[model samples]
Target chain A: MTTETTDAELTIWRDGRFQADEWTRAAEDEAVADGPAILPLERFLAERDALVSRNAPLGVSVEPNEAIEELAPHLDRVALVTLNFPKYSDGRSSSSARLLRERYGYVGEIRAVGDVLIDQMPLMRRCGFDSFAVTNPVTRKQLAEGQWPDVPFYYQPTGSTQQAEVPAGTRPWARKPS
Target chain B: MYRYDEFDHGFVAARVDQFRDQVARRLTGELTEDQFKPLRLMNGVYLQLHAYMLRIAIPYGTLSSKQLRMLGHIARTYDRGYGHFTTRQNLQFNWPALKDIPAVLDDLAKVEMHALQTSGNCIRNVTTDHFAGAAADEITDPRPYAEILRQWSSIHPEFSFLPRKFKIAVTGAPKDRAAIQVHDIGLELKRGPDGGIGFAVYVGGGQGRTPMIAHKVRDYLAEEDLLAYVEAIMRVYNLHGRRDNKYKARIKILVHETGAEEITRQIEAEFVEVRKTELLRLPDSEIERITAYFAPPVLAEKPARSSAFEAAKADSAAFADFATYNVTPHKAAGYGVVTISLKPIGGIPGDATDVQMEAIADLADAYSQGEIRVSHEQNLVLPHVALDDMPALYAKLAEHGLATGNAGLVTDIIACPGLDYCALANARSIPLAQDLSNRFGSPERQKEIGELKIKISGCINACGHHHVGHIGLLGVDRRGEEVYQITLGGSGDETASVGTLVGPGFKTEEVVDAVETVVDTYLKLREGPDEPFLAAVRRLGQQPFKEALYGTA
Candidate 1:
């Protein structure tokens, strides 16, 4: 749950806890190498050939207002997509995550970054976000302790891997009358 | 009435526990007030003028006698011995401690009720025609579909943090008693050309500071695509709905700013993608399962002409008035729908004491097949009273001060909780409604006026739905004084229209006279008493009414 002190360094959280930091988020005009790197969508598009030739894990950071369809053709080459929430109230990224998983059929990890509050984690998880890059220490502690309030069952079916399958005989409304 | 299945029961119970933990966190100072406000609002708890107001949703206004009795119990145990029924077919307890909310929610959960999504930026409680199953003109019962929407929208992953609060209303009948045209999304059940049921979807309709009637987004959408289509609509709004301005953040503003044609285009595009997924599709079996819960109760047909009913009506003029004004024709042959008026002379429009609620519950159990409905007009309906038992029911209602015989009369006003209880109100709507009720309290005078709807709101938020009122009054604060602004020619039915403002506003003391002036003008302008006030206003524009209100032009 504790962060290493480094400027502009990114830590990846996967499967429930923080994993090792390996990918370096590339700055604009940074040279590509045969190593893990996360690039902005614009920079990724500019250096798509070099990144593809590198033959390593690649990720792209997407802005809230960016069209998700622009990354549809590149989904096969990317391993992760980071959806940025400028603020918690701006919900465009949630829709973007759904489009990526359900529409584009992208199987890579989708992480929510920036102002990632603990309360919205459940919702983010429901919308195909597998991980959250939380910046707040208290929220990070809560997430690590599994103390965030979570509702196990859901009313709507979201195409998320973490979604619990609605049990049979529970949805009696889906049964034929005798 | 739709009963809760095991899944529905478990879902509500889990929601209660989740909210209890959230409340505990707020109390322990783990969550700040800003963080706790949305959670509390989602659970229907509000910090009002004096104390916490807990709004309990009576879904689509349908309530079992047992549930009503529980509401009565809660009123007596945790709050003042009274509750106010709102225009949205919910009940609000105006006085409660914040610490008691979890217990209140727990009690409601025991009765298969919870306040989840009753407030919040998410989808709210889905409302439908109060007389859905009993109304003779209905094409099909709408409660099933409303219940479906309620389930789909509850804790929806993507739409929870919407631009603003969204409301959905459904109606199966063509007559539109549910005020479908003024909701964020209005669904009208219609029979397609192939004899299959579908919905005529309307989007972007709302009544607030800026009132706009919803436009038809889909002429005919298949029944199986209900959730998918709604999800498409929500997606479009969630992505592009304005967030910078709270006042202009409603879906109505979105639909208005983005041309309805363009919004429809985007929704259709979104629907193409959404309908392909199994995520939101309504399967035939699911529809059948939900529909089964709303199957109408069997009642043996009785003679159309009840000699006891006729004799009782002939014997008592008061009973005749109640039969004429308070009873509506039921779909069942020998039964009638009875509206028990909560608006007595000089009384608050929708407040009922614990005793009255308990009495109504008893009456519902005895005569109405244990079913009671809360109408948007702030009255309760006993949906299955036998014609032969009208006299006995009327007698009991009279004893409980519920038989006012003013169902559609001028005295049956729909008003909001203005400055009296609401924190957002600018003036007091209850006092104005009381004054108007007292002035038009005479039964004979009310009968003569005949079906003049006077809706008053204390602010521009339009919780009172003043824009659709036949004669609307809006309360505004002006330079430390409360002034009332009047609107004319509003109706909330099939031909829904926002009322037009009638010149300047009136001072508090002068507002009642101004209302009287408008009513007198309508009386003078009408061809006869048979033509109701709304019809007269529609036929003859607002010019004459304006002249009468502010003198000749």
Candidate 2:
């Protein structure tokens, strides 16, 4: 439910910087695009075999609350998994991304799309999102200007910031430098 | 009592910088109100009826004299001259502008305090027994665990966006003064069969429109497993709790819909997987690190009896009443825990002025080891005062109008800042509390009906904790007129139960009489003077009180 549904360019940011986006979002009523493109989960599930056989860097977009178990078995084929925030307040996809990473062991790039604001970058990243579809102009400028949300330390070990070793005596179990 | 380390200091300073930026963006209209709401709430700012209100955390109800004085400074500078102590043992300033919040936070951070996570859907300020390190009956100090939780839950990623706000309470003593059973997550500190520290965990207990007592999930979880077990529970709740309806979004509803056994099974399975991560198994060194911050202050031992206290009581009846009502036994010899009551006859329950706060700070420095605690019951406790200082402390407190001599009596009511200040309130509650206090203003009458708790909430949200009050009053609007609904027999102690609704409703003008009538009925029906109001209600049940309220044929 983002109010910003204006026609705008969608830029994909990944691996420390924004690059030319190879993935195109296919319009629902139109015929499928030729190159690397993402389809809704239902279309992907319905045309699984055909799409898998002719795959050219295929991806699948999921609703925020969609059951991730349905997409778990198809993890081997997809090059990217797109999770939606819908709005900044709706956070079911964080759970979905974690399930994909920790439960299904999906290694493909998981990109956060829709209502991807600047403030949620760190949380969205820590919840296993490796890429983001930058449509929000403010967030785009924020990302472009090299400003980012980086704290001195973190409390929990999840996603990218897991504490792999025991910390020192001064601050153990906590104070994992980020 | 925990002091900020270098890391903590840096984090707080960084957070203040971030919030200041957010405030600048908001004022410049770069961030919409909807976008700014959660951000402001995360920093403990709320847009109330007239202006923004700020809530500062008093972690686990523990406070130092310097920190208390800082709060007074904030009250005097940024807010109305007064601050209200909330049921969560936090402080709420009724008036703080949105622009002023960043500056307010700066002042707070200087004192090693911040308003972080005091509001919003994050794990709120970790509350525990106010008598944590000083109570005579405490098995271990719960503040260390509470501090551990405060750190772990701060800026938490997954849980920061919970379905609904979560509350957790911990208690070291078995008496349950922290109201553990009513929290979303309750941890009772205890020793296991191996004589090692552990916790008895309870989950999904809360009071709101639908109140349910928490179910015990684990009888004994090792102290090392505290964070891991709690993380498992939070994950289970975050994934499965219903999000379709806001009212049913609490973990309590999830625990209710999914049977306790099934929820326990899910949590246990999650715990097995989460413990594999090894990041949260609290090391003994970490526990010791936090526990050292709460080490009790050294006190010189004295005789078992203080002749000065005895002689002062003999000299003045007022001192005798104050000694009898406000003082409780301390774990240290010849020391007493003094409760500085905020409630006065026909006055606000928890409102303390900046002057009064500074006075408490001065007195704490003078008499109580420079340590103070904010009780959940809306009173302040001086944790370690010598018995011989009773008269002097009472006199100084009296000069500042802080000595009310009603710790657990009728006048010591817990009333939320209802329609007077809160935008969510449906009707007025503080007015009714004022009226009731005046009606029972007589010390003789209050002493006769000893240890009665009257909690009032302005709405069904139950911010006043009326559901756990021995006598609860809930305000409702009936056809544009404010009225009240009464509930009885609720107890928040170890024997926790939601109060049963008594029948009918009373007008605003009549609520005071209705409460008096209920009290008088209890006085008549009691087995004797020794039987407290709650005990009589439990023995006789709601039928007798119901008959007395509406009258029987």
Candidate closest to the true structure, highest TM-score: 1
Model 1 lDDT per residue over A35-89, tens place: 8788899888877886666877999999977888899999999998999988877
TM-score of each: 0.96, 0.94
Model 2 chain B weakest 10-residue run by lDDT: B273-282
DockQ of each: 0.51, 0.46
Residue pairs with backbone overlap in model 2:
none
Error of 1 at B301 (Å): 1.9
Per-residue lDDT value at B263 in model 1: 99
Residue B362 of model 1 has an lDDT of 99
Which portions of model 2 miss their true places by more than 4 Å? Answer: A1-7, A16-20, A24-34, A37-55, A67-74, A102-105, A159-169, A175-178
Report the C-alpha lDDT of model 1 over B410-499, residue by residue, as the tens digit: 889989999988899998899999999999899888888988889999999989989999989999999989899999888888899999
Across B192-303, the per-residue lDDT of candidate 2 in tens digits comes to 9999999999999999899889999999999999998998999888778887887899899999999999999999998997788776888898899889888988988988
Clashing pairs in 1: none
Model 1 residue B285 distance off true place after TM-score fit, in angstroms: 2.3
